[model samples]
Target: MYSVVFQEICSRYGKTYSWDLKSLVMGKKALEAAQIVIDVLQLPMSKEELVEESQRKLQELFPTAELMPENSPEQEWGDFWAERTGCAVPENEGLELLPEAALGTRDVFKPAAFTLPDDAGRVYSSLPAPLSRSPPHAVQCLVFEDAPNGVEAALTAGMQVVMVPDENLSRDLTTKATVVLSSLQDLQPELFGLPAYE
Candidate 1:
């Protein structure tokens, strides 16, 4: 659907997106991507205007659009991005922490193994009870989520969240995130007091 829309935009502007340029735009923030499209295609529109028009077009097309096909490309990209960042990519699935090999090298090891919202709340409540001086407080931990439910759970636990929602997610829903990003690649660890990439 996005490809179709992008093609239409290109057709209208008499331009084409190369694979390399598309890759650059893939993980950029919405406005950033809009600016790239407008600039690269030399479209006769401001970034804000392009964003508004794109949103309007998307709104009209989304209801009738088919679901995107499932693929491993995005998963591969995520793995590559995480490795490049030197960050452990722990899979925080239901009540489980599927830490990768690199996780063992870390000095601290506290997995956020929560299956449900109630479980998350319990974890948050217990943090200050046993160790008030140490870290892992709700405010100190930042949640990076792609799902709306996960965002809600983290917010409910009083933790700040940086949500990298799928493109199809409603704009209204994205506001629930403390910060919304296009991808993990766009994350600034320094903003959360984590070590920045050199």
Candidate 2:
């Protein structure tokens, strides 16, 4: 989805979007990514202009894209986690899922009460009573992430992270993850001391 939009943006300026450029921006916030692109490409546009164009292209392209394999429509994510953990994970309680609109592309660039590593701590703090009455130490948390930044955030918060990284990402970038898998389908819960899938 992002690559298509990026390609369109690059083509407009007669610049080809390369894998190297994609890697640099892969896990960055939208504004940060846009700035990087402009600086790297020496594009004749402001970061805001690039971001707006990319967002416009994304909005058009996203509707036609298929859901990621992990986001199967038949299984609600909260329920999936609840079943796997044998614990209640009601939305916004044991688990909080925010839509893209809630965290706007621009919102992440600014300092916030909750961000990245701190957000990981907040999530642990906000776990429902059934999940943890007292704040469970961050060491008790297991995070599943797809980006190097997210893995770093989980580790910074003292949690282990299972990373399912993009195939194009460098192996060196994946070294910090507790475990790395090519896809979510390859995950083995029992390996992490979680119950095996029934």
Candidate 3:
């Protein structure tokens, strides 16, 4: 979806994006990605305009595009956690889902608040009640984030954050992370006290 819209925009400007550049912007927030594209192309468009145009294009394309995977991998990633970590996941606020579906045999939490500094509890509390048996201390947590805002959120909560940034993101924007990596594939979970991948 984004690639198609971005390619269309780039075509208008006689610009082309490499896959690496596309990967970089893929991790950014919508407007942030749009701004990066605008800067890269030196497009005479505001970030808001770029976002609006992209969204309009997405709306037009999504219904017709062969979007859904015919067969999603049978929960390989989620199941791995389910086996080793008891599978408690967080449900962000404002998304619609039933309580049972939201927090069931599979643990899921929705933070009480999204504010910074004091948000550590919210992050912890988002874990299903049972899995939150450990005391709530930010350092005990490790956050993996892609966007600067998410990094800020984890930092404000006093957790160590591992940033997997878009390759094209500014180096300066990633300095605050405890560590930065090109991809989650490079993550060493044991360094953060999690069980190492098998």
Candidate whose TM-score is highest: 2
What is the per-residue lDDT of model 3 for residues 1-198, given as tens digits with 9 covering 90 to 100? Answer: 567777887788788865646644543546777787888778888999988887777667655543224243323444454577533223322122223333344442334223221253433222112122124553466666665655665676667888987776778778989999886656778897888865
Instruction: Assess every candidate by TM-score.
Output: 0.38, 0.67, 0.50
lDDT of 1 by residue, 105-185 (tens): 332434444322234453332111111223434345666766555566567667778898777666676687899988766
RMSD to truth, every model: 14.9, 8.5, 8.0
Clashes of each: 0, 0, 1
Clashing pairs in 1: none
lDDT of each: 0.55, 0.60, 0.58
**1-198 in candidate 2: lDDT tens per residue?**
678878887898899888778777755656777898999999999999998887777667655644335446323443455555432111221112233533343221222122222354543222111223224443566766665666666676676788887787788878999999876656677887876654
Superposed Cα RMSD, model 2:
8.5
The residue-level lDDT of candidate 2 at 154 comes to 62
Question: Of the candidates numbered 2 and 3, which has the greater TM-score value?
Answer: 2
Q: Who wins the lDDT comparison?
A: 2
Pairing residues by index, what is the TM-score of model 2?
A: 0.67
Query: 136, model 1: CA deviation in Å?
Result: 5.8
